[model samples]
Target: MERLSLTLALGDYEHTRDLATGQVPVQGVSLNVLTLAPEEAFFRFTFFREWEVSEMSMGKYVSLRSQEDKGITAIPVFPSRVFRQSMIYVREGGKIDRPEQLKGKRIGIPEWAQTAVIYSRGYLTHQAKVPLGSVEWVQAGVNQAGRVEKVKPKLPEGVRLRPEPQHSLNDMLLAGDIDAVLSARPPRGFGSGIRRLFPDYEAVEAAYFRETGIFPIMHVIVIKTDVLERHPWLAMSFYKAFEEAKRRSVERLSDITASHAPLAWLAPYTERMKNLFGEDFWPYGLEKNRTTLQAFVDFAFEQGVCHRRLELEELFPKQVLTSFKV
Candidate 1:
């Protein structure tokens, strides 16, 4: 039987490398994989649908899904998961030394709908007890000028967000124009005089996980709706292949005989993560990730990234949601 041919655009990550390199194969599908930077892949696929399958920003996906845009549907495969507590940046000698101090401050973000910013704002709102409306929001590129939001979000009442296309967030933060910056990528000024709001972020993130049980999701794998309609089983095939690839990456991370990653004490760190997050530290699928997914959708809605709240069940194809047990 001839296999279904598909193209997948994804970031270069250890977890998905096997699948991208063809070591792992999607059942009944021939994949032509393109490895690109996350920003490039997301922009191309989100705007033009350049590929049949792509890694998408969770905030952007939920925004589109909530608006009932049926251009694409996702499998439960998550290519990126990150904790955003460390993503917040504050200027040296800034007044905002604590989370509560964020009130009435100007915070710069790459986009209001950015996945990382959504999670960061969620933490501020729910965990830090800071009301979203209390702070003035500034939108701009992280390090460069003229960046614009990719999707239109329904801003919640009292939430003030304005775009500064002429200046980057990095420049604004350094110049004291914005009190702080929330972003996934560090600003260009991060090392010089800017520092994380939580300087000891690893402990803070671990504590947050213990309290909230959310290892915030950054990206999800999406397939064009038309392709899924023609081949309904494609979802499960893709899910299974991604699962296997992730499993291998986990195994490599846990291997103590030799280093699978360049970092020192990787094995010990992996073990620590397992102890904190359970054996399947980095998990895929709806049920396994329900807490994180549910929290994200709720945040997306409250932050105006999503037009309405999205249910966990509505996020992925049903095929990837369940499987036949042997």
Candidate 2:
């Protein structure tokens, strides 16, 4: 049989390294991997359906899925995971010193439904006791002016979100127009005056993980519905290839002498990550990740990003949901 040829658009992640280079091959298929910046990929794929397969924002995916727009469906493959404690940027000597201090203040976000903002606000409202209704929310680009929300937002009842079409969050923060920012990207010209709200954010994030067991998910892999409908087996094949590629990537990094990571103590850090997380710290599939996935569903619905809460089985194909093993 002729191998199925497909295009996959994704970020240049360490895990996807082998697949990108063709060192890892998908079973019975040929892949054309297009490495794109995260912002570009998310926007292009979301609006245009530009690629047959893509790495898309979990928040946006869930939002679209909730609306019953079934252009694409996802597998369990997550390409990006980030801890959002450090994503929030605040002015030094500002009124907001702690997460709770954000209450009743102005908080700027690139998008209210951004995955980073979802996790940040989830921790704040659920853990730090910041009431969702207390603060006024502002939406705009972090650095550039006139950034617009690509998808229509479902802002919750009593949530105050003011969209600034004319100014950037960077300028707003510097000018004291907003008290703090919940952004995944740093503001342009970010320096001394502006700093992380938690100076010891690493410790804060590690503790949050210890307590919550959530390494917040960002992007997920999706296949166009038409392609999947025609080639149903491709879902499991793609999952297996991604898993294998990630395994090779891990093996290469764990080899101490090769210096796969730039840090001097990288191997030790890898071991520590093993101890802290698991043998495979970054895991795909549903069972190992249900808690994290469930939290995201709850967060998206609470923040009004998704019109309806969705479960994993509803979001992904049945084949990738479980595998038949030897």
Candidate 3:
């Protein structure tokens, strides 16, 4: 039987390297993988549909789905999961020393629907007791001018959102035009005097994980609806392949013969993560990630990034929802 050939746009990460290099094969399918940075991958795919399968932001996916855009659908394979406590950037000597000070302050963001920004806002509003309405919001690119939100937002009343296409968040924060910036990517010229709002975010993130059990999902694998229409099994095939690749990466990393990662204590850190998250630190699918998925859904809606709240199960194709146990 001839295999289905699909183009997949993804970031070049250690976890995805196996699949990208064809070291691990997808059953009955051929993946023409394009390794790209997260931002470039998203922009290229969003604007050009350059690939049939791509890594997409959970926030943008949810917001787009809420608007009934049928361009793409997702599998539960998340290529990137990160905590956003470290995403908030502030000037070296800024008044926004803590999350509480962000209230009633002007802050810049690349987009309203950025997954990292959504979680940063959620943690600030819900966990840190800062009201969304209290802060004035500015939207723009992190390092360049003229970036805009791909999805339209329906912001709640009293939540001010101003677009500053004339300047990037980096410039705005540096010029004192904005108090702080929320971004997934570090802004250009971000060093020396500029640093994270919480330089001690490592400890903060650890505490947050213990309290909330949310590791914060950043990106998911999306298949163009047209591709899936002809082959529904593509979803499961892709999911299983990704799962196997991830499992193998973790296994290799844990092996002591040669260091899979450059870290001096990679094995010990990997073991620590397992203890922290229970078995697999990075898990795919619905049941294992229900809490993180539900919280993200809630955050998207509350932040007005999504027009309506989404149910977790409805987010992915039904084929990847269940697994056959041997």
In the range 67-126, model 2's lDDT, one tens digit per residue, is: 998999999999999999997888877777788888889999999888888999999899
Cα RMSD of predicted structure 3: 1.1
User: How many angstroms is residue 268 displaced in model 1 relative to the true structure, after the best TM-score fit?
Assistant: 1.9
Candidate 2: which pairs clash? Answer: none
lDDT of 3 by residue, 208-296 (tens): 99999898999999999988988998999889889888998899878877877777988888888888888888999999899999999
Cα deviation at 217, candidate 3, in Å, is 0.2
Please, what's the RMSD in Å of model 2? 1.0
Query: Scored by Cα lDDT, where does model 1 land?
Result: 0.92
lDDT of 1 by residue, 1-326 (tens): 99999999999999998999999999999999999999999899989998899999998999999999989998888888888999999998777788989988899999999999999999999989989999999999999999999999899999999999999999999998999999899999888979999999988998999999999989999999999999999998999999999999999998999988889999999999899999998888889999999899989988889898788888888778777888
User: 121, model 2: CA deviation in Å?
Assistant: 1.0
lDDT agreement with native, every candidate: 0.92, 0.89, 0.89
Error of 3 at 134 (Å): 0.8
Candidate 1 vs candidate 2: which has greater lDDT? 1
**Which is the leading candidate under lDDT?**
1
